[model samples]
Target chain A: MVRIRNLRKSYGSYQALRGLTMEIPRGELFGFVGPNGAGKTTTMKIIAGLMRADSGEVVVADRMLSGKTGQIREMVGYVPDFFGVYDDLKVQEYLEFFASLYGMDGKEARRRTAELLEMLGMTQLRDEMVDGMSRGMKQKLCVARALVNTPELLILDEPASGMEPRYRRQLKELLQELCAEGMTILISSHNLNELAEMCTSIGVISKGRMVMQGDVPTLLRRQRETNPYVLQCLSFPEEAIQILKSDPHVKNIASSGTNISFPYDGTEEEAAELLTALVAKGAQIVSFYREEGSLEKMFLDMTTVP
Target chain B: MRHLNPVYKIGLKQSARTKKTVVLLLVYNLLLSGLGLVVFYLTFDRAGRVREDVAYSGILTLYSVMAAMEFVMILFIVPASTAGAVAGEREKQTLDILLSTKITPFHIVTGKLAASISMVILLVISSMPVLSVVFCIGGVTVSALFVFLLLLVVTAVYIGSFGIFFSVCCRKTTGATVCAYLAMIIVVILLPGLLFFFECLEAFGSVGYIGIRNVMNTISGKRTLFLLFNPVISFVSMLRDQVGRGISIMNSIGSEGGLFYFLSRHWFAASMVSQLVVSAIMIALSAHRLNPTRKGWKSGRSG
Candidate 1:
């Protein structure tokens, strides 16, 4: 639904985006992950037609981003990391106001407002003033506002920030449902586990570049190869450590109490052979399992700047 | 129409629903009534023997005082109101959301300008009863009253445009307000003052009077064009015409009678067109600043 090629932006001496490139297919929930200053928001802003890239090409919802932002804005729903609501404006009025901006007539705006309020479970708060609502409620209202245009591609920057777990879960489920219904969503959040659970595909950006991206399970399974295998010894932990030191595939082996962990770069047959030798050596192994990889771990491993 | 700008509605709704708007209306009308009463109270005879011409003069004076007060209120309040329009949206963090919509920048600029002017108009409409007090004695005409209202509205547009320009140029409302007022002080007060000083030097004390009309009549070269930008001079010129037959100050100075008479007779019309053009330029500049492709606002990074 969105494609960026070699996008670059600089603020004076500091470069924010450095030849970044990525793409999201139609009807996929793409998770955008990066550390601080990794240009995730900048990229999203460029795609949503909120900011101009210094040099690059971006096609969002099949339209090339150019001098005309109006068309792109119509096709894209953008929920920034930090946003505000008009005080003294009722929740329903606020939603309808945004809908009207998208060229919806009064009848269309009312229908859409009612539909969004129902979708957000904010029907009871329709008459309540926007500023009087809680922050989480306001955040949900912002999401509803973004969805008012029924955009083809939705870009949310840190949508789950400061959200309660229950509401966050609801937002996740809502996004998943939207994706299932053929809407393309590009979301950036610090909640890696939530993204992993909810996203159909994941793209990890580091230093303004797409370092890694693929389907969630496939990416994780590929990442799982680098994960360390940890062994727990009921006894003879020193013997297990000595065996690990002798093996070239087992590097940086760490032992604590009865547990020993190290990354293994061997095939399944070689791994089985090593385990058999360790078992026959009277290491008294109690448990040995490869640590599963997570989105959080993968994000840290990819974007942690020294 | 359904195509009315929603931001305008949002601005009007917020302004109307706030206690500040209510308090402003009450205090403004009270000040008008109280001051109108005071001008009459101090001017009228102590005993119950007021003359007709004196009463007529008092009503005219009352009309003049109230009109000047409203003009002054527009000069000050319009700037205060509009200087925060765009900057407030930026501070509230809603500007990005608004700009990211399908609404054009022209809509944002014009919608905000309309809302600001609407607040001033609301004040003027609400105070009509107090102004209507002039009709009790019979001196001021309804057409004159409307001219005053039009002048006030034009002046609001004149001042509000600068306020919005500054609002878009500055990051904070405080900065925008300060800059707007500074710009107004220069245009309304200093521009005329400097031009008059130069006119005084050129006249070399030959003129009998040292007033604006005299200086305007005596002003020479392209310097007279600068006074067209002064809103205060425009209103004062318009006021001088309505009240005093405007004196023969325009035709009395040398053979260059044509330009002076035209300006002296139609200062209001000339200045209205001139100021509106300037205001349009300011609005266009502001819209440019809010342009999405412009490298204006600081872009925040996600990393």
Candidate 2:
């Protein structure tokens, strides 16, 4: 649904986005992961038509992002990392206001406002002043406001930032439900575990460059080839480690109590063969399992590239 | 086009709730009528005599009051209203969310400007009782009052334009507020003071009065040209001409046959055309400022 090519932006001497290129497929929940100052916000802003890119092409919904900014704005719902609400405006009024901006009339705006507030669990706060609501409630309200126009693509920058755990779970559920409804979402969050659980696809950015982007399982699988997996033994852990280290496919080994971990580059057959050889050597098998690969681990491995 | 655009409804609600706005309107109406009542009572006994001096001095004083009132109101209101328009949005961090919507920049600019001017007009209308008191004395016709109201609207439009412009340009509320105030000071007090000083020099035979008169004329003409750019000045000018029978000092000096007499004869017609042109320009300029995504004037479209 979204494609960016050679997207570059600079703030004087500081380059925020450096020829970053990536594409997000339609109806997929894309997770954007990056450390501080990684051009995540810059990229999102360009897509939202809120800021200009120095040079690049962004195509969304078959229209050039920059040239057809108005159309693009109509197609996308954006929730910024930090946001504020009109103090005296009620929750319903706030939602209705944004709905109207998208050309929704009074009756239509009221209908959409009611639907979004209910969906986001903000119906109780409909008549409450915006300032009187809690931080989590306000964030949910912002999300509802963004959804007022029923945008096909939602670009949310840290939508779960200040929410309590329960509300955060509610936001996750709402996002999952939206994704299930075939709405594309590009979400950025520091909470990698949540992102890993929620996102079907993920992109890792570092220093304005897309270090990696693809399906979550594929990325995890690729990174796992180089990841160290631990093998635990009830006894003779050192003997098990020594046996694995001697194998050519096993590059290195580290031990913790009765657990021994090593970087394995062999196929599943070879790994199974090595385990059989260890059993033949009389090493007691307490636990035999490969380490679970997650987006958080892959993110740490890629972005921590010093 | 959305009948219930959040920005529009919220803007109107906020205006209604603002204590400062409510108090300003009340005080403005009470003061105008109170002072106007006293003027009427004093001149009630000499209603016929007031018309005799409908000459240069009478027009000049009226112009002064008109200018002063609008300038002062702008000085007070623009800072309070527009200083917070964009800057507050940024501080709230809601600008990004608002910009993300289909509402064009022009729409946002205009919506804010309309909200502010609505409050200003409310304040101006509240003083109508005082204006009605002027009718107790003769020579101030209803047509004249209509012209005066037109002038006020024009001047308000002009002043309100600058407020929006500055609000858009400045990143911080304090910066916008200070810049707006400074600009007003230059337009209302400083520019006139400089012109009058030069005129005084001409009076002392150091330079020709015509030279000083030309400077004032240029200023007045420029002011008229940018009338919509600053409505406070136009409103004051119109008020002086309609209620007080005074010509702007600059116009008086610049035009031949004593500029005041010239304006006194064609007050309504001249102001109507001049202000309309100025208001159009101001509105267009404001629209331009609001559309930041557009590199410059070209074949660009607004959402």
Candidate 3:
């Protein structure tokens, strides 16, 4: 749904992006993760045609992202980290204004505005001033505005930034639902935990470069040797920790009272065998399982300087 | 080809919410009408007050007030209306979101510029009664008032476009507003002062005041062309034509059958052509300003 190659954006002496290349498939929810000054927002802006790239090419829905900005704009829906709402305009009016800008006529604009407002659960507040809305509500309204044209590619930059926990969850669910509906979504976010939960694929960027990009499960599996496992014991937990720490396959181990978690360099089966060995040695084991790796770990691992 | 009614709706609502703006417009209209009525009452018992000298002063005051009001309105309203147009969107971080829509940059520019001047147009329309009262009391014709109003609208649109253009270019609203005002002062006031000052410098030469006279003659001749860029000056010329003199003012001031005389005889066409050209340029400049990829120092590198 989107392709970017050798995209570089610089402001005076500072380079915001450096030959970043990425592709997102149709109906996929791609999470863009990076630390501060990682060129995430800059990449999104270039793809959305809000800023010019110093060099390189971006293609959205098979249309070049240069002179075809109007076409690209039609195909992409963007939600920025912070969005302004006109103080005097009502929620419906704001949506309608965008609809008209999209070339929809009066009747059609009104119809789409109503539909999107209802979809975003803003129908009840249609008459309310947009400025009077809560941060979450405004965020949702921005999402509604983005979807007013039913864009094929949604480029949302930190859409859930100021959203409360509940709304964040709702936004995640909504994104998942949209992806299921065959809408491709490219999202850049600081909240790795949430992105990991919902994104089908993820891209990690550092210093204006894409360090790693792949499906979440595949990324986790490739780095599975770094996965930590917890072994809960009913007795002799100290001995269990000492044994696990001494094991050649084990890298690091930590004990929390009866619960012990440590990195396992060996296969899952071998790790299970180690747990069995502990039990055979008169260590009563309650449960032994691998700890799930979150996108947070993957982000830190990718972005942290060597 | 899209129907801009939705933009129109939002624009109207946005302007209506500004109570301060509405009150200010109301005060302007009341003052204009009050001043016109006062003149009418004062001149009621006088004989031959409508003659050249008396009419010149009364109408000069009226025309001056009208031109000044339009200038002040454009000065205050354009910046207040358009200072935030694009910069504020960026500051609020909504510009990216807005640009991501199917709306082209041109559409966004037009919609924003339209929204800015929507209230100014409404206030101009609402001032019609007072404007007509000026005509009712004075010797000015209805066509003159209509033409003046048209001039005001054109000036407002041109000024509003500049404001939007600057707002789109600058990252800060304060900077955009200040620059727009400064540009206005240069075009309307400072440019003329510089021209006259040069003429005075030349007057001290061997040619004496003859150089000054020639310069003044040139200005009087090309008054319409000069005033075309400065709407306030054009408005002043329009008022001067309506109240004091006609094509003869050019001859009395200096040269005969020059640009001012030609414009005085064809004020409508001259004003239309000049305003249309200026408005188009302003609109084009504003559209160019909205281009995200346009060549500029601040243009970010894309990687």
Could you tell me which 10 consecutive residues in candidate 2 chain A have the lowest summed lDDT? Answer: A236-245
Ranking by DockQ: 1, 3, 2
lDDT of 3 at B152: 71
Per-residue lDDT tens digits for candidate 2, residues B1-303, read 445445656677887987887788777766665655444434433443765433433333333353355446655775567667766776677776787889887778777777777777777677666555444434557776666666666556655666667777777788888877786666656765665565566555544454545544433333233332334444545555555533455254345445444543454455556655654665677656555355532211110
What does fnat come to for each candidate? 0.78, 0.56, 0.66
DockQ values of all predictions: 0.62, 0.40, 0.50
Best by DockQ: 1
Off by over 4 Å in 1: A235-253, A276-284, B42-55, B205-217, B245-249, B252-255, B258-260, B295-303
The lDDT per prediction is 0.85, 0.72, 0.75
State every prediction's TM-score relative to the real structure. Answer: 0.93, 0.87, 0.87
Model 2 misplacement above 4 A: A237-242, B1-6, B37-71, B199-244, B247-283, B295-303
* Candidate 1: tens digits of C-alpha lDDT, residues A223-285: 889999988888765565577789989888877888888899998788888888898778888
Model 1, B1-303: lDDT tens digits are: 687888888789889888999999999999999988887775564322544334446666778788889888888898889999999988999988998899988789889988989999999999999999888877788888888888888889989999999988788999999999998899898886787687877676786457766666666735666777777767766666666534343344323556756776677788888999999999998888788787655554444
Interface RMSD of every predicted model, in angstroms = 1.8, 6.4, 3.2
